[model samples]
Structures are given as C-alpha cells and as structure tokens.
Target: MLAMGEVHTGLLQNSGEISESTCRQVLGLMAGETVRVSRRPIPHALSPERLTGVDCALPSASRSRIRGVGTVVSRCAVTGGRVAQGSSYVRVVRSEADRRLPWSHYLSRPGVVEVLGKAKAADLAEGFVGDPAPGCLDMGAISGRFLDLVQASPLLDRRAPFRIPRTSLRWVAETGEPSIRFTLHTEQERTLRLTHPGPFTPAVVDLCEDLATHDWLLTSLLIIVERARIGATPGAQAVARLAPAIDHLLHLWMPAARVEEWLRPFWESLERQPGFTRQWRSLVDRVRDQIATSTLALLSAATEAGRR
Candidate 1:
C-alpha cells in the first residue's frame, strides 16, 4: 500500500492572531461538524475532514497507463491563528475488479484509491515526486481550494501582515524498512519519500503537517531577509524591512513541536543534513543586529543635535 499527500501553507489573511471562536467560524467547512482544537504547545484548530471524488490516470515513471478511482480526503488547519494550511491525502490500493466502481462504493472508502491495473509503488512514488504529466491526480490543486476557502471567508479582514507566496510539499509513504527522505525542489516546492515499519496511520499525516509548517516558516524568513538587502540598504531601511519577520515569523521556528514521538527521528535526521534551525538562528541574529545598530544610530544623532 502507498499513501500520497500534499500540503499548502501560507499566512492567515487576518492582520493579527485570531481568537478560537473566530478560527472555528472561518474553518467551518462541513455542516454540523465540530472543528478539533488543541491548546497545548500552540492553539491549533482543524476543520472536519471532507472528501473529493477523483478518477484520473496515475502517473508512472515507466510511462505505463494506469488509472485510479476514489475519493481524496482534505482538511484545513489554523495554527496560532496566524498560519493556515490545507492538507490532502489518498491511499492507493489494488482493486479486485478492473472497472470503475459506483460513486457510493468509492465514497464508502474515503481517502482510499483503488488502482484498476498493474502498477508499482516505486514507479508511482517516483512519478509523483518527479514532474507529473497532465491529467494525473492533482492533490496540490485540491489542497489549494481548501486554503482558498479559509482565506476568502468574509469574517477575515483579508489583510495579511505580510505578502508572501505559499509553499507546497508533496509526500509519498510506503511500508518497508523505516526510512525517510526529504528533498527541496524549486523555490516553492518540496517532496518527501518515506518507508515505515508499521502500517500507515494518521500519525504519519500529523508528522507531514508539522514538517510542512516548519518548512514554511523557514522559507518565509529567508525571503524576508533577502528582501531586506542587509548590506546594500541603509541600516534603518533594512531594519524596517525586516521588522515583520520579528513580529510575525521569528517565534514560529519550533520544529517537531507537534510531531509524534515515533516520527521525531525523521525530523532530527532532516535537521542534521539541512541544518534548518542552524540557518534560522543565523538569520534571526542578523535581523536583531540590524535593529540594534539602527537604534544606536538614532540615539547618536539625537545626542549630537542636543550638543549643537
């Protein structure tokens, strides 16, 4: 069995962190369903899971023709009332019959897609992480729609504190010897391949969400620093450009904060190679130095004016 998912992360449209009640109202995607909330570590709220019907060709590395039919599961999450994420995933399994099933049959098994023909897990995984051709299952688009729903809510002011592009992470997991590999593709895209010893579970989904959240934080901060033009721009001007990072993005560098214990090792391994926190700390320090230097310059000018 193989599972694939994608997550889209971006800043909430609200100017400031929103309240729990507001989060619930914004993420109320399903009628009569309660949004799950967890207060510890951070204030997080999750919309009830919704399913979307999909019948499309499954991409294969070997270029073989394969089709899958089922429903894709999706949900929206709000973290600290500042960041929003839309996550979608579907499990791939072999079908006993080689033809399309009834919509009710597919709906009965939410989040599970049945492949109608021969296929290899490795090929599908490779094709998904690699460039996918047109007409293949598009989980990224599905995830984006859910995110749009929350961002378009009338309750929100539609004014984000900062203007930054969203980031997407595509991941595939299969049961095997325990292992994980995460790769950063182009600027706004990433992919992950994992092999777990136990059966696939929802905790794996949680792990992916945590990774995506931290990855987004890192990406947003890097963009902010680049925009500041630290050395070329004037000290005060650079500090002004980076002020949003300190206010909205700096404290969100908590990696594995919401990850399950069993999946913590995956995050630890990633840290060693990529050194996510190491780079984040360096950027944070640089921002702080710029601010301090600008303050000192202002003080010096004030003193000189008084003396004159």
Candidate 2:
C-alpha cells in the first residue's frame, strides 16, 4: 500500500497576522466541525478534515490503465496565523472485488483508494511522483483549489504584505525499511519519498506538513533576498526591500515543531545533508546586516550634520 499526498503552502492574504477568532472564522469549512487550535510553540489552527470523492485513472509507471475509486482527505492549516496550507492525500490499496463498489462503500473508507485492476504499488507510486500523465489523479490541483478557497475567504481582506508564489510538496509514503528522500524540481514544486517500518499513520502527514511549511519559508526568504539586490542596490534601498522578510518570516523557522518524536529522525537526516536551517540562518543574518548597516549610516550622517 502507498499513501500519496500534496501540500500547497503560502502566506495568508491578510495585511496583519490574524487573531485566533478570525482564523477560526476563515477556516470554517464544514458547518458543525470545530477548528483545532494549538498555541504551545506557536499559534496554529487546522480546519476540519473534508472529503472529496474521485473515480479516475490512477497513474501507473507501466502506462497500464488502473482505475481507483475512493475519497481524498483534505484540510486547511494556518500556522502563526500567517502561513496557510491546503493539503490532500489518498492511500492506494488493492481491492478484493474486481469491479467498483457502491458510493457508500467507498465513503466508508475515507482517504483510501482501492485499485480495481492489476497494478504494482511501486508503479503507481513512481508515476505519481514522476511526471503524471494527463487524466491521472491530480492531487496538486485538488490541493490548490482548497488553498484558494481559504485565500478567497470573505473574512480576509486579501492584503498580504508581500506577493510570493505558493510552493507545492507532493509526497509518497509506504511501509518498508525506514528511509526518506526529498527532491526539489522547480521553484514551486517539490517531491518526497518515504519508507517507514509500520502501517500508514497521520503522524507521517504531520511530518510532511511541517516540512512543507518550513520549506516554503526558506524558498520565500531566498526570493526576497535575491530581489533585494543587496550589493547592486543602494544600502538603504536594499534594507527597505528586506523589511518584509524581517517583519513576516524570519521568526518562523521552528523545524520539527509539530512532528512526532519518533519522526524527528527523518527531519534530522535532511538537516544533516542539505541543512535547511543553515541556509535560512545565513539569509536572515544578511537581512539583519543590511538593516544594521543602513541604520549606522543614518546615525553617522546625523552626527556630521550636527557638527557642521
């Protein structure tokens, strides 16, 4: 069995960080479900899990037609009332019966897609993370719509402090020897492959979401720093360009904050090799250095004026 999912992460379209009350109001997807909130490490809000039904061709590496029918689990998450994420995933498993089951039957097994024909889990997994064919299961598109829903909330003023592109993280997890691999394809696209020792659990999803959040923060900060043109532009102008990152994202680099203790090693492995935090710290220091330099120049000018 393989569980594949995608997370679309970006800044909330609001001028200022929203309060918990407003966060709840914006993430009120279902009528009766309550939005979950946690404030320990930082303020976080999660919308109730919603299901989207799909009966489509599951992507297969061999180019064979494999049909799957089930519901996809999706939810919206707000971190520090600033970052918003829309996530969706489905578990693929072989079906006992040959043909499709009734709608109620599929609904009973939420987030689990049953394969109706002969197919290898590896094939489906590879095809999904690799270039998926047209008319295949499109988790990215589904996740994007959910994120758009939250971004389009009437309660929000749609006045984001900075305009940055959203990042998409598509991940696949299966039971096997423990290992994890993360790949960055383009500016807005990333992929992860995980093999754990036991059955699939929500903890894995939490781990992926936490990684997605921090990855977006890093990517957005890099963009901000590049656009600042620190050396090319005047010191004051460069400092002004970096002001948004300082105000919004420099403080949000808490890795594994929401990941379970058992899952910490997965994050640790990536940190050791690629060093996500190391890169983020370097960029942050540069932003601060620019601001400090600009401040010192202003103070020196004031002193010179007073002397004259």
Candidate 3:
C-alpha cells in the first residue's frame, strides 16, 4: 500500500494573525467535529478531516488505466493563526475484485482508495512525483480548494500583508528502509518520497505536513528577503520590506514540532543535506541585521539634527 498526499500552504488572508476563537471559526468545516488546537511551541489549529469521494485514474508512468475508488481525506490548518494550509491524501491499495464496487464500500473506508487492475507502486510514484498527466488523481487541487475555502471565509478580512503564492507539496510514502527524499521542482511545487520501516500510519502524514509547513516558511522568507533588496535599496526601505516577515513569519519556524519522536531522524537527515534550518536562520539573521542597521542610521540622523 502507498500513502500519497498533498499540502497547500500559504499566508492567512488577514493583516495580522487571528485569535484562537477566530481560528476555530475559520477552520470549522464539519458540524459536529471539533477543531483541535495546540498552544505550546506555537498556536496551531487543525480542522476535523473531511472525506471527498474520488473515482479517477491513478497516475501511472506508463499511462495505464488504473482506476481507483475511495474517499480522499482533507482538512484545513492554521499555524500561529497566520499561516493557513489545506491537506488532502488517500491511501492506495490493490482491490480483490477487478471492477468498481458500491459507493458505500468505499465510503466506509475513508481515505483509502482501491485500485482496480494491475498497477506498480513505483510507476504511480514516479508519475506523481514527476509531471503528472492530465486527469490523474489530483490531490493538489483538492488541497488547494480546501485552502481557498478557508481563505474565503468571512472571518478573515482578505487583507494579507504579502501576496505570495501558495506552495504545493506532493508526497508519497511506502514501507521500506526508512529514508526520505525531498525535491523542489519549482517555486510552488515540491515532492517528497518516504520509506518507513513499518506499516503506514497517520504519523507519516504528520511528518509530511510538518515538512510542508516549514518549507513554505522558508520559501516565503526567501521571497521577502529578495524583495527587500538589502544592498540595492536604502537600509530603512529594505527593512520596511522585511517588516511583514518579522511580524508574521519569523517566529513560526519550529520544525518537527508536530512530528513523532521516532520520525525525527528523517528531518535531521534533511537538515544535513539541503539544510532547511540553516538557510532559514541565515535569512532571519539578515533580516535582523538590516533592521538594526536601519535603526542605528535613523538614531544617528536624529542626534545630528538635534545637535545642529
């Protein structure tokens, strides 16, 4: 069995981070289900998972007609009440029968899709991680729509400080030798391939979401830093460009905050290679240095004016 999912991450369309109550109101998707909130390392809120039924062709490298039927799990999340994300995923498994089954059968097993006919896990994984052909199972779209739903909520003012595009992270996990591979295909597209030593679990999903959250943070910060034009523009002006990031993003970089303990090695391994935290800290330090220099310049000018 393979667990494939996508997460869409972006800024919450509000001038500032929303309050806990507001976060609840914005993420309240299902009627009876509760929105879970954690306030330790950061104020995070996650909506109850909602299932969407799908009967589509599984992405195949050889363009095979591997039709699958099941519900896809989706939910919206708010991190520090500033970053919003929509996640959707489905577990793919081969079915005993070779044809379509009743809707209720799929409905009963939420977030599990049964593929009809023969299909190789590697083929599907390759097709998905690479450029997927049109009309394949589109978890990215489902996740994006969920994000759009939250962004369009009346609770928000639709006044995001920065207008950065959302980042989409597609991931696939299978049981194997416990390794992780993260690839950035484009500014907005990323993919992760994971091999765990045991059976697939929700912890895998948590790890993916956590990585997606941090990756989006790093991407957004880089954009902000470039826009600051540190040396090209006046120090004060550059600092002004970075103000929104300091206000809304810098403090939200607690990696693996939600990941299970045993799975932390995966994050640590990535840290050694691409060095997500290393780059993030460098950006943070640059932002701070710019702010400090600008402040000093302003202070010196004020003192000189008073003396004159």
Q: Which window of 10 residues has the lowest lDDT sum in candidate 1?
A: 249-258
What is candidate 3's lDDT per residue for 1-308, written digit by digit as tens?
Answer: 79999999999999889999999989999888899999988889999999999999988888888898899999999999999999999999999998889998998899999998889999988888888889999999999999999999998998889889899999999988988999998789999999988898888898998999999999999999998898999888899999999998999999999999889999999999999999999999999988888889999999999999
TM-score of each: 0.96, 0.98, 0.98
In angstroms, the error of model 3 at 158 is 0.7
lDDT of each: 0.90, 0.93, 0.93
- The best candidate by lDDT is 2
| Higher-scoring candidate on lDDT, 2 or 3 | 2
Name the weakest run of 10 consecutive residues (lDDT summed) in model 3: 124-133
Candidate 2: stretches off by over 4 Å: none
How do the residues 58-112 of candidate 2 rate in per-residue lDDT, one tens digit apiece? 9888888999999999999999989999999999999999988889999999999
Runs of candidate 1 with Cα error greater than 4 angstroms are none
Give me candidate 3's TM-score against the actual structure.
0.98
Which residue pairs clash in candidate 2? none
* lDDT comparison, 1 vs 3, better candidate: 3
Residue 201 error, candidate 1, Å: 0.6
lDDT of 2: 0.93
| lDDT score of residue 139 within candidate 3 | 93
